[model samples]
Target: MVDARGLSCPMPVLMTQKAMKSKEDYYEVLVDNKTPCENVTRFAESQGYKVAVEEKNGEYLLKISK
Candidate 1:
């Protein structure tokens, strides 16, 4: 899991990108706000990942999978 909950834009996406280097079948990204969730979803989808979102305690969890 990529814990990007307190992070801002680009950083979350960038970190997720770095994690993607491992080429796993699934990814979990945690962001505390909506923007990062949307941004990450966009970037992941652009990279051919299917993004599913879940929210809890004001935090967004992005599940990215191939």
Candidate 2:
């Protein structure tokens, strides 16, 4: 799991992409802002990956599974 909260813009997606490069099953990302979440989801979707977005309190949870 990658906790990307407080990160801005493409960083979350970029970091997640890097983290998932070595992953073969599932990954989870946590972002405080919606834009980063959206960007991450977009990046994941572009790669033909499945992502689930959920809100817990004020934070966003993005889970990508292969």
Candidate 3:
């Protein structure tokens, strides 16, 4: 899992992208705000992964898979 919580915009997306380089079929990204969540989701989707977001408390958990 890429823990992007407490991080800002491009950082979350960058972290997610770095994790994706592992060539895994599935990845999980945790972000504290909606902007990072949406940004990461878009990045993952653009890379051909399907993104599913879940909200817990005030954070977002993004499940990205091919």
Candidate 4:
């Protein structure tokens, strides 16, 4: 899981990229705002992962899986 809460923009995307480098089948990215959530989801999907999003308490949890 990549905890990207309190982080912004490229930071969240960068963390997700690093985690993806591990070649894991699935990953979860957490972010507090819409921009990071959208950015991370886009990055994951562009990499061919299926992206699922859950919103709770104004935060977003993105589940990315092959």
TM-score of each: 0.96, 0.91, 0.97, 0.97
The residue-level lDDT of candidate 2 at 32 comes to 96
Residue 40 of model 2, lDDT score: 94
Tell me which of candidates 1 and 4 scores higher on TM-score: 4
Ten residues in sequence with the least summed lDDT for candidate 4: 36-45
- Candidate 1 at 38: error in angstroms? 0.5
Each model's C-alpha lDDT? 0.94, 0.89, 0.92, 0.95
List ranges where model 4 is wrong by over 4 Å. Answer: none
lDDT of 1 by residue, 1-66 (tens): 999989999899999999999999899999998888999999999999999999999999899999
Q: Give the alpha carbon lDDT tens digit for every residue of 5-59 in model 3.
A: 9999899998888888889999999999989988998999999999999999999
- Give the winner by TM-score: 1 or 2: 1
Candidate 3 wrongly placed segments (more than 4 Å): none
Residue pairs in candidate 2 whose N, alpha carbon or C atoms collide under 3 angstroms: none
Quantify how close model 3 is to the true structure by its C-alpha RMSD in Å: 0.5
Q: Return the TM-score for candidate 1, rounded to 2 decimals.
A: 0.96
Name the candidate, 1 or 3, with the larger TM-score value: 3
Q: TM-score: which is higher, 3 or 4?
A: 4
Backbone clashes in model 1, listed as residue pairs: none
Q: Rank the candidates by lDDT, best first.
A: 4, 1, 3, 2
- Which is the better candidate, 2 or 3, if ranked by lDDT? 3
Q: Which scores greater on lDDT, model 1 or model 3?
A: 1
